[model samples]
Target: MNVEKFKKDHNEILALVAELRTITQAGIAKNADAIAQQIRTMSSVIKLHLAAEDRVLYPALAKSQNPAVAKVGERFQQEMGGIAAAYMEFAGKWTIGSKVSSNPEGFKEEANNLFKALHERIQKENQELYPLADQI
Candidate 1:
């Protein structure tokens, strides 16, 4: 019923993605510190956002008498595991700016792919999940 926090988190994520894209494009070697900081910030935000969904959003949807709603929630929750795992691996691999700096192009490629996936997920939630939450 209350999706304000989730919307806010989505906005923050998009903002962070934009910032990362800009800084990474400018040059990872020169902007490693900034890039690393952004990565850390995004990681923190995403972790919290996912936890909130697990504790609140998913449960609410699961309670819905509508079978479609319950299935949607289950699908979203299950799909999240892969994304979370990929994110953890990405974050761990590039914990240090030096690691990112060591392979600027690789980092950029990986970051772009990962961010795209995350962006798509957020869009789906905003368009589909949140609306369902409101209806229920």
Candidate 2:
């Protein structure tokens, strides 16, 4: 019934994304260290958020008597696995400041794509998933 924690995590994730966007707008070469550090920070938050969802949220929804809700949960869980994997790869690849510094353009392109994916996922979770959970 209480979905505040997940909502808060979503807010934090979005805020970190906004900060990353702002840092990269000035260009990654000059902000490599900051970018890498921000990524690391976001990684920590994301790891915790995902862990919480896995431990508490998904299982509950999957067991729900409401078939529609269970289906949505299963779909979200399956979809998130890919997004999470991509994010882990992206975070691992760019966590080093030197890596970001060496290939700012590549980092920018990859980051743009990854961030877009994250944004879409978060929006769906907030608009669709959480509301379903609230109903349950």
Candidate 3:
């Protein structure tokens, strides 16, 4: 199952999430450039990570004997698509050098929603899905 690789990826994502949370909070408090850079970095890392999973882990999990686990993996993939769309939408809205202060509340709301969902997904993967994958 390569639990070490999964753990490493999980930790990296967690660190990125922390950075993202700081950047978004700073943006809400009037620092747009930092937020923009963080968003760009996060977007790249996330896309790459998802691509790796879709290319490797998902196919392996789907072919496993456990129907319940495979179904969960499929559902996770769908949820990941939704998260990716949300990230892209937020990235589009908050371009570099844009005036975040002009619409701080809206930006903050979107960032919060995105982070909350991401955090929940990460928790689930770390606590439930990854271990299950290891067992399988």
Candidate 4:
């Protein structure tokens, strides 16, 4: 596996996280439009990154008979399913046809939580999932 390729995606994800951070810190009242834009941008980035993981990383480890590989691969994929859903829901609710939620404050709060979750998941994938995949 060209481990190097994965780091590029990591960097892209990190950049999106930083963008979200800036938007969230700006306060939903002041930056509602900008926040919505960033969410749209972030959603696109994550979709591509996740698709790459599904193509290259998950499948390889998931196919392994080695128990460790199977377990970690399965776990990451499962967690990713929920994360993807939450992301889609948030993005759709805030950036869809109508655009922006009814309550900016509530949307801001959800955005902050989403940022934190993405950050944590990326850390885990880098520290545990990808490393374990490399091992097996």
Candidate with top lDDT is 2
Give RMSD to native, each candidate.
0.9, 0.7, 2.1, 2.2
Ranking by TM-score: 2, 1, 4, 3
Local distance difference test values of all predictions, in order: 0.90, 0.96, 0.76, 0.78
What is residue 128's positional error in candidate 4, in angstroms?
0.5
As for lDDT, the candidate ahead, 1 or 2, is 2
Which tens-of-lDDT digit does each residue in 1-136 have in candidate 4?
Answer: 5556777788887897787677767766566677778778878888888898888888888888788788889889989999989988888888742344358767767877886897899889888877777775
Candidate 3 TM-score over all chains jointly: 0.85
Which segments of candidate 3 are over 4 A away from where they belong? 24-29
Residue runs of model 4 more than 4 Å from their true location after superposition: 96-102
Model 2 lowest lDDT segment of ten:
1-10
Runs in model 2 with CA error above 4 Å? none
Candidate 2 per-residue lDDT over residues 1-136, each given as its tens digit? 5788999999999999999999999889999999999999999999999999999899989989899999999999999999999999999999999999999999999999999999999999999999998887
Candidate that scores best on TM-score: 2
- The count of residue-pair clashes in candidate 2 stands at 0
Question: What is candidate 3's local distance difference test score?
Answer: 0.76
Q: Candidates ranked by lDDT, best first?
A: 2, 1, 4, 3
Put down candidate 1 lDDT per residue, 12-51, tens digits, no spaces.
9899889888988898999988898889988999899999
What are the TM-scores, per candidate, against the unseen true structure? 0.96, 0.98, 0.85, 0.86
Estimate, for each residue in 3-97, the C-alpha lDDT of model 3 and write its tens digit: 56766776787798798677665545467777777777777777777787788777877987999989988887788888878878877777663
